[model samples]
Target chain A: MIYLELFLNFIYVGITSFGGGYAALPIIQHTVTKSNEWLTSTEFTDIVTISQMTPGPIGINAATFVGVKTAGVLGGICATLGFVFPACIIVTILAVIYAKYKKSDVMSGMLRGLRPASVGLITSAALSIITVAFFGQELLELTFASVDLIAIVIAVIAFILMKKVKFLSSPIAIIALSGVVGGAAYLIQGALV
Target chain B: MKEKRNYKILLPLFWETFKLSAFTIGGGYVIVPLMKKKFVEKLGWISEEEMLDFVSMAQSCPGAMAVNASLFVGYKMAGFIGQAVSLIATVLPCLILLTAISFVYVAFASNTVVKAVLTGMSAGVAAVMADVVIGMIGKFIKNKDVISVIIAAAAFVCVAIFKVNIIYILAVACILGFIINSRKKGAGK
Candidate 1:
């Protein structure tokens, strides 16, 4: 039941997810963290970090991780199957008849709305991750006193480095460096205090 | 393009997507270009124009774009067998690697140093996401339609402020998108 349940939930994720990449983040957060309580917010953020640093989409990473954690390797495969199942079926169907459906009004029309709407979805995800980066929580429960200034500083510097420095703009490189800098900074601060 | 049913193509398609999934770190946008290079330029399995079709089809369909793109390419090249092979190959890398990480993630996640690294990485994740948002917004503005703009703005408010579920937001956006854009289909010029 657990394997089936994980598979089905991820199938739901696969079906509902559109716009791709960061667009899927909010839905993943909703399914795994909020709706199922399968993962805490921190774990969700951790998965995002892992996905950023490694190859593959966060959906695959989430499904595999949660699957293994819950029920070993089989769970991982089951969840992954769920994650890719809907996409496989849908895209294959499109491939079969695509010569005819190419540029039809319905496809273009849906995309026009969906693409921009994805921007909004990614924006929401960005905000959520930003809040977690700064405050260690999902909700925007911010006060001056409660904020982690070091993390905020790291985020700003990371942003600036990305914008101003051409060599440092690679998202993978900067993210990896930020982890090093953040760890060292926190360690040094702990020593000082 | 001949529709192939040969079992031979199954291996090559699987290998190609396996390489793509193994190297691509940023998902849909990242894997897609490399896929173009490998499938279109190098192997010549699909044409330039056909690759563009695959791109749009992958992006527009529900689910992750990387999986969708690979599936489309696989199915187009061979048949249902190719599709199955490619799907397994594409997902295999992540499943193996991430599951390995998951085994050790609990231990690493509990450590102070690893916690610090993850925390720092989260900051970087946030920054990168913000940059992607800015870039997309600039592109969205140039070819902006009134309805698309309104939908984007409304979706942001609905999710970021009101905390509405994305399922609802996307549903409304799709229906709204279909209704508004469908009406403008006469010339599409």
Candidate 2:
């Protein structure tokens, strides 16, 4: 019964999700918290927070957590497999089709349209994260601070380093430096405020 | 010269993808350069332009960029067997890493250093994402196509402000693509 439910949930999330992992967030939130009642809204939020903090896609993380909470280790396996199953199958079919249709005009035209949409989605996500990291749940009007500004600056600098500096191309190093900057700002704010 | 052994071709592709899957932290744009490094510079599996094309295609698809990119790269490298190996390799690491991390998370759910690192890295992640967008924009602008820009703006408004469902956005894009292509073909005739 648990396996069946897991299978169903996996297929539901996998199939309905069409815009990538970030786009699946609302669906996972609604299903787990609102419909299934497996996780409270608070728990769902926490899972999202923690999942984002860790490395990997949020969909897989949520699936893994929900799977473990509902059942156990086997549940985890089922859920992970379910989450990845769609992409696996799609790629297999696409691999063969792609061979024959590699240079089709129709395919090229479709791709040209898809590019802008993809860029839009990616930009939206980036802007949202920037807002949240800087504003921290505050309203837009009341949120302008130095640390926030500094974080943005750090991001820009890191971008330049990545694009131009050539040697400081390590994402890990840039990430660590940004954290040090953020922590220092936090401490300074604590002392001043 | 290509090897004659049956498993020889598949093994290297699988191993390369497996390593990438295991190590690539903060998915998507973060992995782009790493991919460029491995696929273009190191392995010579595909050319740089082809790599960029694969990234563009992966983005338009309906899955994680890491997974989709891996699928294309793997297929381009070694065909069906390459795809299978890459999928397994890509997914296996995340599964194992998350499973192990899940246990530790239960205990150290609120570690300070961990939190700090995550908060900081997230900003960097945002930067990488912005870079990808800018890079794509540069590519699009070079084509000097008004249709692409208009569609891009429309999609941005739909997703970012209106928060319209992504499926609808994708569907509309697909329809628009078909319509525009067909009309152009008809006019040519």
The lDDT leader among the candidates is: 1
Judge candidate 2 at residue A155 and give its lDDT. 76
Residue-level error in angstroms, candidate 2, position A158: 1.1
> What does candidate 2's lDDT look like per residue over A101-183, in tens digits?
85787766666666566566656655666666655442344446534665567677778877786555655455566667766
Residue-wise C-alpha lDDT for candidate 2, range B55-171, written one tens digit per residue: 556655565667777888877767767777777777776667666666676554677656655566566656666665676667678978778777778887887788887667766
* Candidate 2: CAPRI quality band: acceptable
Please provide, for model 1 over B1-189, each residue's C-alpha lDDT reduced to its tens digit, 9 standing for 90 to 100.
Answer: 655378878778888789878756544555544554468756899875466457556766788777787888887777778788888888999999998888677665567786677677767767776776666566568766566567778988997889776667766766776787767665586
- Cα lDDT of candidate 1 equals 0.75
Clashes of 1: 0
- Candidate 1 stretches with Cα past 4 Å from truth are A1-75, A94-100, B1-90, B101-106, B143-145, B185-189
A74 Cα displacement, candidate 1 (Å): 5.2
The digit string of per-residue lDDT tens for model 1 on A128-179 reads 7788778877665666556888889998999999879977766666677888
